[model samples]
Target: MKYGYYPGCSLERNASAYHESAMEVAAALNLEFAEVEDWNCCGATEYMAIDMLPAFALISRNLALAAEQMGNGRQQQLVAPCSACFLNLSKTDRYLRDSPELADKVNQALAAGGLHYKPGSLRVRHLLDILVTDVGFNAVAEKVTKPLYNLRLAPYYGCLVVRPVRKTPFDNPEYPTSLDTLMRTLGAKVVDYPLKAQCCGGHMTQIKEHTALEIIRRLLKNAADYQADAIVTLCPMCQLNLDAYQDNVNKHFGTNYNIPILYFTQLVGLAFGISPKKLGFGKEFVDAAPALKKIGAEPPPKAKKPRPSKTALPMPAPAEED
Candidate 1:
């Protein structure tokens, strides 16, 4: 089936691996994705809290663009790989449909660009939702050329993905099992993680790091408690907060937690027999080699190259390729 893919900002840079592996997995599954052209950010999780009208308007632009981009005969659904983008776009669409006055105001703003989106014109969906429901676990399991045997994993949904249930309405917000089931389909042993749908500190790591680390520590501690080899994530924000700050979390709590944080799509790509490098394997701060080795599928470490001169280029945060 074909879909309107909205990769969002993070996927292009920090989560480039997520974008790479997702494209690889979608190709393997025979799913076609036509990216939304000239798409902008969804205003993230912060903008809405700052200003409702502007935030909704910003998000509505993407929906308007996607609605216009769906060329005749293609489905009117736009799938987002980023949780923040999915939530923002879906929330704005739902609200615009629910409120006529707000829709009028947003449409007025879009008028300058010669675009107007009718609420409900496009369906906003998460990549995971499409995979589990449309693709089906059985169909995905059939693609297991290299099942992730002997690997123990904790499926971390974080928040936002399944939350605001009345709006999203697919999985249980409190305790989602879609990822758990997906991991099982890949032949990886799924751990009984209580914090499966828990918050991953999100931007709290930036605002109040101590609080964020505490929240992050709880999730990591639980995975460690269950002896999970790695924690699989659905959101890039969750992966960034947990993976990038893992060392800081360890230092702050005086605890040693090195569980590799991986994108669920990466594992799915691995199960499809895609090389780890192609799946963005070694991009994580906490090395995934140890965990991948358990399944006898660890990719060789990439060779380090000389750093670019400071005057020549600025490095990307959350680690860039060597």
Candidate 2:
């Protein structure tokens, strides 16, 4: 299916691997993505909090451009690969549709640039949502030439894309499982990760170093606890925080955590038999070689749980039972 693609800012730089892997996987899946012409930054997560009108206008400009490009096409969906971009675009559209006063002001601002947008004119969707929902797990499974067997992955949803729940959200906001199911379809084992939907400290890393390190440490520690080969995520910000700051977190916490943070698309490309270099595997700060090497290898045997001692005291009974 054809859709308008928004690579956002991170995809052009630090998260280039996400863009590369997405394109490779899209090609393998026979999906056509026409990039929005002259798309600008969606203001990410900060601009909206600073100034509402300009932020919405900036985000709406892309929507207007995408709508104009589609021009009567049945599919007017605009896909943003970055979590920040997706949330900004989706939030602006929702706000514009809900508040006519804000919409008028945003349109007035847009008019200065000879552009106008009507909130719901185009549908804003995240890359992961579209992949799992529109593409279908069965279709994705069919393309897996080399299954990611024996590889254990913790699917990290971060906290943005699924929050401030939409009228028709693709996945559960509190506890999303779409990514988990997608990983399993590629033959990878999905670990039980409770913090999958937790925040990854976004720009806080730049503002408050200590706080950011603590948050990053929690995610890394949780993934390590689950014995995951890697933490797979759809958000560029989450990957940046976890992968880029792992060493800093280690230093601050005095803990050694070598968990690799990989994009969901990278794993998809790998399962489709794409080469690691082509999928931009080495671009991440944490070395993914160790985790990638375990893809087809046999899983380690499970350790037996220790039996309770016969001399141990009996457990206390509940007050009601007593």
Candidate 3:
């Protein structure tokens, strides 16, 4: 199937692995993605909170371009691999369709750039939704040359994608199982992770270090408790938070967790027999090789580290009120 692609800013830089692996997996599945021309940022997770009109305008610009690019095509779907991008795009389209006043203002802003987007002209879908729903698990299973046998994965949805309860959500928002089902289709063991839809404290790691670390620590602890070999996520922000600041979380919480945070597409590529190097495997902060080795082999028993008693450690000092 052919669809318009929006890689978002994160995919071009910190989350390049997601883009690379997604491309390889797309090739394996005979999917065609034509990138939208001159696409801009999606205002990320906080831009809308800072300023509503500008944020919607910024997001709507991409929508306008996508609609123009896929004019009258059988498939007018624009796929975004980043969770924030998907939400921003989808939310903007939904809001514009519901609020004519807001759409008029956004279009007035777009008029300056010679672009106007009619709401609902194009369908915005997260990459995972398209992969699982459109491509179908059976088609994906047939393409897996190296099934991820024996690999235990905690599918982390990270509070986005299947959220805000859209009119036709592809998965359950409160407790999603699409990612879990996808991993199982690849022959991997899916852990029953309750915190799968919890927030990863997006951008909060920089705003509130202590609070963010605690959030990150809880997720790591839960996944570790389930004996998951790795935490596979669908969002770039979640992967960045849990993988980049993991050391800080460990130091602050007095925990010795060593769980690897990976993108779901990476495992999908691996299952399709793609080389790790080509899949952007080494870009992650945590080394995925150790967890990946568990596939098709009897991994040596993990060494248990003595965790410090929570009661013994002093609670983090409260943040001073402004």
**What TM-score does candidate 2 get on C-alpha atoms?**
0.91
lDDT of 1 by residue, 20-101 (tens): 9999999999999999999999998788789988888888888988989895344488899999898888888888888899
Which scores greater on TM-score, model 1 or model 3? 3
Minimum summed lDDT over a 10-residue window in model 3 is located at 313-322
Model 3 lDDT tens row, 160-257: 78886457889999999999989988888888888999999999988999999999998999999899999999889999999999999988988888
**Per-residue lDDT over 1-322 for candidate 2, one digit per residue giving the tens place of the 0 to 100 score:** 8888999989999899999999999999888999999999999878878987788889889988898888844538989989889888888888888999999999999999999887788889999988899999999999988888889899999998888646777888889999999998998989989899999999999899998999999999999998999999998999999998999998898999999999999999999989999999999899999988887744445556556588878876433200
Q: Which ten residues in a row have the lowest lDDT in candidate 1?
A: 313-322
Off by over 4 Å in 1: 72-75, 165-168, 296-322
Better of 2 and 3 by TM-score: 2
The positional error of residue 295 in candidate 2, measured at the CA in angstroms, is 1.5
Candidate 3: regions farther than 4 A off: 72-75, 297-322
